[model samples]
Target: MRDPAANNGRELARSPREPPSVNCRLEGDPTPMQVAKRYRDATPESDRLPAKKARLLSTNTQQLGTENETQTKKTTLQQPEPRRSKRSYASFLDDFADEALVHRRPELLCTFVSEWLESVESDREKHCRSDSHLHPSDEQPVARLRTRSAPVMVKARDIGGFTVPPTPSSTGPPSFRADLDDDRSRSSSSSTANVRNPRYRQNNLRFNCIHVRHATSPLPVTLSGHVDSLRAQRSSPGLSSDDLNQAMYRIDVLAEGCDEEQVVKLLDDTVFPDPEGDDTFGPATGLMSNSSTLMAQHLVPADGASPYRVTQPKPDRLYGYSERTVGGAFTQSQLLAQTMLHDRNPDYTTATSRGLRFPFLAIQFKAVGGTRGDLWVAANQCAAASSACLNAVHQLNISLQACQSTRRVDNLSYCIAVDNKLAELYISWREDSSNYYLQQVDTFVLSRPVEFQSFRTQVRNILDWGKDARLTQIGDALDVILEENRKNAAQAAKSRTSPPDDPAASAKRQKPSSRRNSKGSQSSQTQICATNPTLPEAEAG
Candidate 1:
């Protein structure tokens, strides 16, 4: 305290411009030590927004990456797996069994197995090494032993006295040596082996024999009393020819095989019974007598002993109306055997046929009833006509070539539907193309109570159109098709034989044209010079 202010003033005077020390403090401000203590105390409480935001962003980025990876994994799982090749061989066998089952012939399985085994053996033989220890002669004894058990072997011995020879000494075991004869004997044995080893030939012959026997066997006649029953039905009072025609159509549609009596009985029981009325065609003796009398008059031949043949009935005569005339007797199938369709058994198995061939034409008469009837039913009739037409075309194509001469075979089909008041005729034929397609040629309608004469005229017009117009059109179309095919074949052959285009040759050809064009331009310039003498020489050039 001895003069302290004066001492501080003396220190300041000594260094007037000297800066203050870092730890020095102003009068009103806190001291440097106090500020440092304050900063240290508040450090833990300071905001850290940037760091927090960075952490949140990093976590979101990681979550997005994980989600992307999960999405990629899900996409991979959604795809269908590729097919394996190992199952193809099993599928082929399954297909083979299915096809064999379709034929209803289990023997086909044996045939397929035999063929497969033969093919496998052939392939094995082809791939086998020639120098291998397995000698071809070693397998002969097994084959010979197999063939000797066959029934054909007995027949072969009786026919040719063919016998299997012993194995050559070279191929036999070392202990069992056999002497060889002349070369002729070896040649004879080789030839015999070649001829006798093919056991399939014998099997084929046996199969053919069975097929021939089955085909030639006559179908049993089951319509012994069919005529009698039909006659009985015809004599029923109030029954018209239309009813009779309907009955015949029903019979034709339902009958299968030669069982006409059964068909008639079924029709009587199911279709023809008049449920609404008491008067029905049931099995009655009185009706049979009347039917027999009617049968003797019309259906039966003049000679009662001759077998009755079914014929189309003549049109009924109307009072005060003249009779209509039609040309040619129209024949319809009254029995299954007479129809053009293939015969089938009750099981739907196709019956074997003899060599006899039926005609190509098939006609069905359908009766329309009520007001418009079903449009779908009418459409089906068209389809039926088309099918019949195509079947005829196929048969013709197989049996005969297109008539090279003027005798054109008209393959047309017709389905006629008639009601009490209206009649419709549908005509169909095959159109020309790479494949035959059915086409409706025309549809004709006639008012009900139509005269037979008008019907005949319309039919004759259709026949004429088919014979003259349609046939000629088809032939012309066929000719055009054949010509186009010939042209295509020629073009194909020319393309196959022609040389490839050469760029150098094409350039050479272009050069000549370019020279000619230059010459043409030069001539034109000279002509201009002659016409305009005052023109400059450079301009003319």
Candidate 2:
């Protein structure tokens, strides 16, 4: 008999390895086997890996799919992937219906369906051809339609109107791979994609609507109430008329030729006093100036080559605590359980000191002579930063039980784009889980002492509110979420450990089977599973 080790050595010594049996390349990319063959051809035989090592490596790599004489392996064993936590289109529709009922805007839902149907019909007409081939003349129209649909779908999805088609299974046929590739290409061009160049107008349509609203445009009741409360706040009693005069004088002197750093220093000294410097402010407040420290990766827009890579917002002035000051302390086991259940860090989605938990305010400051263009750039930065802040709260809300009434509160975050001359206050809120809105509430000419004072007062009020009201709200919500989590754990444990039903009792307990009801219930359960797998079976029951 031939030596088994010699046969293995001969196999490993072969010039070109057999390629994977799967037909069709990935987007026309070279297969791994082809690349390996090329590398082997270029390298000298003497310089190649030792025959024993190469054989061992090949055997190890192919072990998942390699066949023994007893059976011909047709499939590789793979660890099952975790199900994605994304909510489904049906759940989105339910939320939309609920929102419409609450707002008494039933017409909105009708309009949404009509618009979607119209677009779909138009798309079908453009693509349909007698020869079953697209005409060159129709290409531009089809392209335009696709371009328009991408944003529409992104916006609709954000607002709970768009539906994502079901993803192809991993074990699906080669034909299914084509659909997956098409989806990947389509998503790349969508507004929902990770953007490298963060343009305010180009990337954020909802944000644009908020910033462009007319001065007289009515705001949401909750938002308007917060705005009014901000306006009602009085200026610092410590800041007397003399203090205002001196600050204004200093600002006027620096207004002509100050750099960004000088402007930041001037404001820090005169207008926005350091919270830590004042004993009254205590540890409740935190300030980070010109720090390029990165926030949580998921919280910010992905702008790097890798989707998971961190993006730094690096606002001029960041005002928020480094940690949550309220909420019940979690034991180690409870923290571990939370980590396993939600795949969350114990930091509550915050990464570092610059994470700025529950940040209510951010400032993007420029030099005195900064142009309107410069202010626009600052606004973009502020918008990105403010969105991250809102996202942190939204993630926390996701952890709460579905039965909870209050998951999120709006108008909790605000940003200011300011120079020595002009300052604009923008309030940030979420219409739903994904739709983030940032609207300009007020503008102030810092050159004028009255407007400057008004600006200072509003900033102070926002900080105070964040420290007290916002923190309390967040703390209460966190406690409730933790309590719900505990309850869920206990119930799960009980279900697992409770004694099995007695067979004698079970036989006696059996009732007349209602086939109609049984079918209906099973169908209902199937619908729930298909549309919302994230929902626990216990909850569904």
Can you give the lDDT of residue 330 in candidate 1? Answer: 17
Query: Could you give candidate 2's per-residue lDDT for residues 391-489 as a string of tens digits?
Result: 767766676545374665443588888777788898887764556666789998877888887888887788778767776666566666667777888
TM-scores across all candidates? 0.21, 0.50
Pull out the clashing pairs in model 2.
none
Poorest 10 consecutive residues by lDDT, candidate 2: 16-25
Off by over 4 Å in 1: 1-362, 366-379, 387-414, 418-423, 427-450, 504-541
Candidate 1 lDDT over 300-391, as tens digits, reads 11222322211211111000000111211111111121122222321111111111111111222323333334323333333322332344
Cα displacement (angstroms), candidate 2, residue 238, comes to 4.6
lDDT of 2 at 527: 92
Which TM-score value belongs to model 1?
A: 0.21
At residue 47, candidate 1 shows an lDDT of 62
